[model samples]
Target: MRKTTYLLPALVVAIVVVLSSIFVVDEREKALVLQFGQIKAVKEEPGLAFKIPLIQEVVRYDDRILSLDTQTIEVTPSDDRRLVVDAFARYRIADVVQFRQAVGVGGIRVAEDRLSGILNAQIREVLGADQVTSDRILSKDRGELMIRIRDSARVQARSLGLDVVDVRLKQTNLPQRNLEATFDRMKAEREREAADEIARGNEAAQRVRALADRTVVETLSVADRDANVIRGEADAERNRIFADAYGADPEFFAFYRSLQAYETSLKGDNSTMVMTPDSQFFEYFKNELSTNGSVTLPDPVARAEAPDAPAPDAPEAPEMPEPFNLTPVDPAPVDPAPESPEAVDPTPEAVDPAPAPEAPEADTPPADN
Candidate 1:
């Protein structure tokens, strides 16, 4: 019973000592000592520490870097590119006293709030510069732009005793109005290009088809002309052969042609001919009739009695005109003796030559006047 009593008091003292002087610092935390609500010292190492039982107290704070996920915000670039930026930052508390003095018990909240405002300002300042335009900022450059924003925010956020390791975005997007306008314009442009290309193809196809048709027409026309030329040459050769045969015997040709004409024009029932019974041409048909047993002829001597062979086809005589009755007139008597040129006067008139003064006759001699 005495040993049990001694063990109980020792256990009570050990529990008091364990509870009063022991301090633990985790890997992610720092232990701070406070005297009468005033910070006396800080233990940054991760291990157990000692503190006065009733005079000093230990407080723990997070020493490792922590993350603060800020709210998403809409931002406009310099060249009218709109996007939503969800930003987050990594920071650590470097000055615990200042953090507590500024935010009381909820000091991390104050730092996060202040960091959000400052990070937003830095993002706006960097992205709103002249270089960050719609054309310059692309999906490939998003990571690089984030790095620059984080670096710039680091310098500005370091003054608050909290290191800003990084600032990141969760998402980025265009505004509704800008997205709709871009989609509509792209659709219209593609449709117009397709229409123009199709029209050009159609025009080319038509031109090619028309050219082929023209070529076909020209080829057929040339072939037709050549065919006609060949036909004319064949006809000329046939005519030449016939002329050679016919020039050998013109009379036989005429006789054969007459027979052909008779067969064509006179063999029908409606044919007629004006011919005598004993005519020369009648012999052809007369002999033909006898060959067909349609007619018989007596001896040539008895047949000579029939008009004596039609008088051997009498020769035709030309008609003579009546003679006119006209009497011939005698020329006038001419003087035998020659007259001298002085006997004639200038005019061509008949003048009688006067005999030399002759003896008187029954009539008195003409006076020489």
Candidate 2:
């Protein structure tokens, strides 16, 4: 019974050691066997793995893709514009043995820290290159920039047994102090462009207005010149007609002109003229002239040039004559005297003061026909 008890204790201890040496690795994990801080073996596949119990231990790391958000950092681009940038990276541990050797006991946390530093440094180098600018970082080309950063970071991360699958820029913006200044600069640029456009428009408008004004002046001048030419032609034709009529009949023309003057001078409700009673203006008013129809009017031009005759000497001063009235006055008609029985027919032959000496009595008696 004492021998059975010792064997049973030994078997239980052996079972405990075997169970501790055998470990099952999960599909999502990578296992590293370490002997006193030195990497002895790596388990990259999911299944049972063996290790010397009490002398070695297995360290497992996630084999799935992992994500890390880098800290916001400030970088200056080629144009000297500073920017605040935020980024994220997707990665996985590709070499568990290398990872265990590099990170030691710190494991994924330490590896992540180192990867973050690598990503940040690569971002600065690529984004701050001579050809890169702040505009490129915030534009569609940012994808290209991120790819460059990932490639550069992947090279550096390989030393840490990490594979950088992709890197992306999440946020890229101007610093707080620069935001207002940038906006102001943009506003000023736009305003300058607008002012330039307005000036150009005004210049074009002025050009159009000037052209229109010149055209208007030219048109009006041409029209006025034509109008004046036509008016002068009309006046010349009128004078020609007047001259022809005057050449046809001087007496009739004079009478018609006098009638026109009278009509002009004696118009309206009240018309007055002061002149002598025997003035030539009333020459047609004489009964003898009116009955004879043989009116003669003095030529004004001849009268104006002729010297005045000497006044007749008067024994006494003549009395002042009353002013002539222009108003028409009808005279009383005189009745003809009745003919007497012995009245003489006053022919020119009977009116001779002295008888013409009978034309020496004809020698022969006149024959009657």
Candidate 3:
């Protein structure tokens, strides 16, 4: 009985000592001792910690930084633009007592919900308003709007006994439905610009073609005028040369012209020309017809005997040299005895002057009267 009593007392002392001594706490967690629903101690340091065994309860909570990510929500601005917003936050518990009171072990999810609401409210208020729409933030100025939003979210997240260290926004973009409209508008603008360029090119081409036509016309006209002037000058020079030749020898010119005409007109035709026997133009034909024909000039005396008048039956010859005319000599009187210086005998025949024996009367008997 004495052995049992000593053992019970010793065991009771050992239990008391164990309950009053330390409990281990990790760096990642905070330990709280609770007695009768009241906080008796809190251990924020690492290593061993003491607590009452049955009278006090130890509750450890994560003291490390944590993250809360919210679901995307449709945010509408005053301009009626709606977009999905995704946001996240990082926090750690600072006041373990307050954390326990505000957000119990299972109530952290609820607390996160409350924090999300606060973050959303602040984001909306700073970045947007019900009556006004703006991406600009006033507290952090216009350029640093995103920074201010994150900072403001962190500050506002503390109300739920949670500290927010970082807040981030991942993506913000137009929805699929708006993309096609934007592309269509861009295409329309490009088409307009292309059309304008084409129109200008056509205008330039028209101007060039017009200029070419005008140049062609002017060049052709100038060439035609030059040709006409040159032709006229050539014709005038030809006429002058011909006139000078004719003026120099009209008769010769006429002969040449007649020969040219005969060459041109009589060569191919089958007509024969006839003329009188003694025609000047018949000389060639007559000479050709006679076997012994010879071309010779007429005797001068004969030409004088027959002054060749233009015969109506004769074919005319072009102007040719005229034949010379000659006179017929009187028959010389037998030279009557050499005309013996006889002019002295001018008396009728001579026989000394008078008493010429007249042919006696014998011869007288005039024949029967």
Candidate 4:
């Protein structure tokens, strides 16, 4: 009974010791065996690992890729333009032992902090180069700049047992103090371009308008000249026709002109005219009587020199000849009379014994059609 009690207790103590010495490492993690704060073994593979109980302890670290977000930082480029930048990084523990030694009890937390500082420093150095500008930082070429930051940060991260896989700028922006000013400048530039375009457009339009006006003036001038030429030709043709008609029959032309005049003057029922009966305008009417009989003409100069009113009640002049008949009549043969002395001289022999002048004849009315 005594042996059983002693063996059972010893077995229990050994089992406890064995169980405490065994440690497990997952596929996603790496294990570190440390003896009094000094690394003794590294378990990089997933499996059961042994350690001295109460003397050696195992620390597990994630072997997967990690992410780190850096704080926003302000950097000034070579042109003295200030910018705010945010960045992020992808990294992994390349040397777990070195990581443990470097971070000590703080582990991944402390390592990340140190890595962030290194990344920030590298970012500032590369971006603040003499040839670097804010435009380059914000452009597609920014990818190259990020590569440079990663390469640079990778070198510095080695000391903390970190491998920087990639570095990227998350945001690049103008500082708040300069944002409004930058926007104002851009707006002004656009407005100036717009004004220039408008001015050019107006100038082109004015040129087109002027060209159109000049063309219109030229066209009108040509049209007017053609119209004047046509009118001149027409007038010449009309004059030629008039000349031909006049040359063919001057008397008939005169008659036609008189008829046209009569038509024009008597176009309306209310037409009125005042003229002496012996005026040339009535030559046709007077000549109608001459067609049947010869007309007698008096010498104006002799009549004016000799004609004077006879004394009243002097010897009655011989009975005056009767007036000619107005209607047409057949000719009748008659005896020839002796020539009168007054017929040649167109004056009486004695003006003082001349008879009173016969009453004037009444005016004849125009013939009806």
lDDT of 4 at 286: 37
Model 4 lDDT per residue over 1-369, tens place: 999999999999999999999989999989999999888999998889899999999888999999999999999999899999999999999899989889999988899899999999999999999899998888798999999999999998998888999998999999999999999999999999999999999999999999999999999999999999997887677677766755554444455555444544454435455555445664444322244576533332333344463322322234434442223222243332223222221112211232446999999998998
Question: What is the Å distance of residue 81 in model 3 from its true position?
Answer: 2.1
Best by TM-score: 4
- The alpha-carbon root-mean-square deviation between model 3 and the true structure, to one decimal in Å, is 25.8
Per-residue lDDT over 132-248 for candidate 2, one digit per residue giving the tens place of the 0 to 100 score: 999888889999999999999999999998999999999999999999999999999999999999999999999999999999999999999999999788767766665675555
Instruction: Give the Å shift of residue 134 in candidate 1.
Output: 2.8
For candidate 1, the 10 contiguous residues with the lowest summed lDDT are: 345-354
Residue-level error in angstroms, candidate 1, position 19 = 4.5
Q: Across residues 1-369, which tens digit of lDDT does each residue of candidate 3 receive?
A: 999999999999998788566689999999889888788888999998887677888888888888888777666556655555677777787788887787666656777778888777766665566444433322234435556667787676555567778777665444567657757987999999999999999999999999999999999999999999997887677666656745554434333443343343333325344444454332323222223565543332332233343312323435534452223233323322111111222111121222224564554455665
Tens-place lDDT digits, model 1, residues 1-369: 999999999999989987889878888987778888788888888888889888998877788889988777778788787877777888888877766665565667777898888888887777777778755555577777888888888877767767787778776767777888878988999999999999999999999999999999999999999999997887677666546634554334334443443444344335455544444442323332244566453233333234234423322323433332222232233332222223222111122222235867697788999
Superposition TM-score, candidate 4 onto the true structure: 0.63
- Model 3 — which ten-residue stretch has the worst lDDT? 339-348
Candidate 3 residues lying further than 4 Å off, grouped into runs, are: 1-21, 105-107, 130-143, 175-369
State in Å the error of residue 94, model 3. Answer: 2.2
Every model's Cα RMSD, please? 26.7, 16.4, 25.8, 18.1
**How much is the lDDT of residue 121 in candidate 1?**
86
